[model samples]
Target: MGQGADHLTSNQAQVLDHLRAANAPMTAYQLLGRMQNDRGAVAPPTVYRALKALEEAGLIRRIETLRAWAPVATVRPGVVVICDDCGTVRGVEAPGLLESLHERLVAEGFAEARKTIEVHGRCGDCAEDRA
Candidate 1:
């Protein structure tokens, strides 16, 4: 908490740490449990506040379908891909992926739409295990 600590408040730092270390997305309630020791009296409001701060800083993102949060994979605008089998939420990365998607949407007459895509399915690990 000493080095580069001024970038975040203690609560925000604690919340980000938990999300960064998580293998899967976590709800705010779950984050409270993980941060209670550091936060000393973590509650729903406290966690929510921290989450908002982290989101504002672009350090994390909330998966609307899962109602959980995960650390942002990159600074670029991208889509969220949620693994249904393992509940892992990750950012999708592909060259010009967003642009292609936008082009398709525009062709479909949804040019004015604001896109927020979340593709749900088994991830590579689970898919391989099943095969």
Candidate 2:
């Protein structure tokens, strides 16, 4: 379990483990399927609840555009770079960038703004392949 995840339920920890092992984002249903395949007959609600808890605890992030979830790779503010071609999602840490972004938002009168920025582009390997 992660530092903050010491209080997670068993199911939530399992979900977090699966997400950490995954190379890309996974939808809730997909997680359920994996669990069911491994352990048999896990309910959809069970997985959904676990996901909710994990997300709330900052152990995971939801990719709104893809409707998928990814493990939080760091404690910094969430930023994900999605590979449009291969569907790879990689977390990135940019505290300075996040601070500037929040500053800009505050300047525009957006109060207490929290952000999860998703940038879509080809990844290095994919770009090299294309080249």
Off by over 4 Å in 1: 1-6, 37-39, 74-76, 100-114
lDDT of 2 by residue, 43-112 (tens): 9899999998888887888898899998877323567889999888877878788789788888999886
lDDT of all predictions:
0.77, 0.82
lDDT of 1 by residue, 6-34 (tens): 48888888888888788888899999888
- Top candidate when judged by lDDT against the true structure: 2
- Residue pairs with backbone overlap in model 1: none
What is the lDDT, from 0 to 100, of the residue 91 in candidate 2? 74
**Best model number under TM-score:** 2
| TM-score of structure candidate 1 | 0.78
Report the Cα lDDT for residue 28, model 1.
Answer: 92
Q: Which ten residues in a row have the lowest lDDT in candidate 2?
A: 71-80
